[model samples]
Target: MSNQTFKFKQFEVNQDQCAMKIGTDGVLLGAWASIEKQPFAILDIGSGTGVLSLMLAQRSSAEVLDALEIDAMAYEQCVDNFEGSPWGDRLFCYHADLAEFTEEIDDQYDLIVCNPPFYSEDYKTENTQRDLARFQEAMPFEHLIESVSKLLMKDGVFCTIIPFKEEDQFIALASALNLKVDKRTRVRGTINSEIKRSLLEMSFCEPARSDDKNVINTTELIIETTRHNYTEDYINLTKDFYVKM
Candidate 1:
């Protein structure tokens, strides 16, 4: 709950130097993202403190788990976190911007995950680090999709979490790049609250040429029934990581 550190069942993420602390969005994506085939290689963009990559390392037997972090402080923290984990040998961090990494790296990953900055509001924060971590301008959706297309294997899955309102536009943009949503989950804070986030799994595989255009699998997840009252679905999905769960 604090910015200092987040202790998970299998790993501890120290975010004291990172602008974005561990939160529900990252946990949800880490736990909910489908790793059906047990990918051989995985990549986490904007890795922050490398929580997502750590979670994937705990969940799957992936041989390689690489992370990319642009911020110097966050990149250093991410490397420290990865090195301290049990899967340290299999985990690695690249301290470079997405554009540079994409341009220089030729190896493709079986899975790519990103919890990108989706806030497009016209506002400025005194903290430049927080602004860079929270603003969409730092990494636009188009650039993210383009990089994913190039860095992901042909059948690789791209999982991400974004504002629920951006779902349509995001899907459309990805579709333009031949990425189709294979699965999607609309996330709400409570049963009565409006959807706040969307967890999406997209790939290059196209839907069957059938009459039904809505081939994407869709579902909904309610995190809580009331204040601090976690839902069974949420607990079931994240019980492996969260201490309280």
Candidate 2:
């Protein structure tokens, strides 16, 4: 629960050096992103503490797990966290923004995931690091999708978590680049609350199990029945990582 470090069931994440600490959005994306393809390689974009890559390392036998972080401190912290983890050899972190990483890394990944910054371009605070980590200008949806289209293998999966309001626009952007949504989950803090975030899984084509018309398998997730009272679906989704779940 502390910003300094978060203790997971299988691994520990030291987040003190990062501008952004561990949060529910990151956890949901990390746990919900499908590895059904049995991805041979995985990439985590904007990996704040490299938690998503670490989680995937624990869940999959993937030989390569790479993470990218733009901030120097966060990148160093991410590397430290990965090195201290059980999958040290399988994990590595790069210190560079998405654009630089996208341009330099020629290899494609079977699975690519991101929890992108969504704040409006008009918004700003004096805190530069936090601004870079939370502003949309830093990693616009279009640029993100375009990079993903190039970095993803032919049959690869691209997954991300974004604000519910941006879901339609985000999907549209990905669609332009030939990335189709194969799976989607709308998330809320509680059953009574409005949808807060969208978990999206996209690929080059529609899922083989369904027709092209059925672009996505949609679902809803309510995190808690009430404060500290977790929902079964939520718990099941995160039980593998959350110690209390």
Candidate 3:
């Protein structure tokens, strides 16, 4: 639970050099993101400690696992984490901004995942690294969507976790780009708490003409039933990574 490092069942992420440490959001996205097609290539945008890519490597037989980190410190830390991991041969980190990467990379990925910063409000902390990693201005939702539209394969799945309040707007933006939501899950901290996050899976493929609608599969996930009490669904989803789950 320290910022220095996070120990997972199959991997240990040393995040001392990174501004963003391992968190529930990344773990949830890593574990919940659909790997149904057994993606041969995967990309993780804004990989902090390379934990999300590491988790995907552990779960899938993907031959190529790439991650992108704009921050120099986090990028170096991500490369170190990936190199130390068992999937070192398969994992790689690019020290470039999303825009540059998207413009340069021509290869499309079977799956793309991003746990983006959502703090859109004008706020600043003395810690510049933390601010860059926590603020949405650094990588707006529009940029993320545009990058995904270009880098994702026609049948590829794009998964992301964002603030629940932004779910509608996010989906609308994706829809404008012809991306349709295939699956969605609203997440709450506890049974009594309001929805805090939304896990979404979208694809560029259009629905059948006969169907016309996207037919999104929606569900809800409560992380805990009470204080420190993890729900069975939550545990089942993340138990493979979190040691104590």
Candidate 4:
């Protein structure tokens, strides 16, 4: 696959040499990760193509943004993308696993976002690059939670998108590390379909009044409709990155 340049509202991502190309999961996590007050330091775990890190750069005024990737190809692609971006000075991609990055970094981050591999099944693909980008064997839920628990600051927000079926289990894992879910949004292709993915934001301290289930859109015509015609909300959410969205 060739490296392609994906244009966003405020940035363009050049992802020619990445194992995981631009996908809905990365775009959703990038657009959905909250940066309300603007974080000072941010971390993107398993940063493939550095899309989420770039999105966070556009969303907040963070001085330092770092990305950690275990895959060598993805790490190189991330470094290239970051260096080509305007925020190259502040954005750095480390060619290391998440656990290693967490152990070496002494600084805490106010925002930590990850588009983790959640497909915990006994399956394999012919494409080794995609497998490395999509598989979560090296970094399980427990391992990620423990690493984040140690790296996240007192008021930090750890954001991620996981399969809806694993939300309960994922939350349970995070809770073991004393990280409570502050906000979550269950996404569906349409109003009638079952929820497919859950975008969650967690923090060390439980909110005084935590809310549940912030449904984003309820449109039936997107998936069932023609290939080219997408829903308004879906288009709105991804218009910035997708070429024709």
Which ranges of candidate 1 are over 4 A from the true structure?
Answer: 207-214
Candidate 4 or 3, higher TM-score = 3
Off by over 4 Å in 3: 207-211
Clashes of 3: 0
Clash pairs, model 4 backbone: 3-16
**What are the candidates' C-alpha RMSDs?**
1.3, 2.2, 1.1, 3.7
Residue lDDT tens for model 1, 11-97: 899999999999999999999988997899999999999999999999999999999999999999999999999999999999999
Q: Would you list the C-alpha lDDT of every candidate in the order shown?
A: 0.94, 0.91, 0.93, 0.81
Q: After superposition, how far is residue 112 of candidate 2 from its true place, in Å?
A: 0.1
Q: What is the full ranking by lDDT, best candidate first?
A: 1, 3, 2, 4
Order the numbered candidates by TM-score, best leading.
Answer: 3, 1, 2, 4
Q: What TM-scores do the predictions have?
A: 0.97, 0.95, 0.97, 0.86
Per-residue accuracy of model 4 over 7-93 as CA lDDT, tens digit each: 765667777777778877778888878889589999999998899999888767999999998888788888988988888889998
Model 2, residue 5: distance off in Å is 1.6
Q: 8, model 3: CA deviation in Å?
A: 0.7
State which candidate, 2 or 3, has the greater TM-score.
Answer: 3
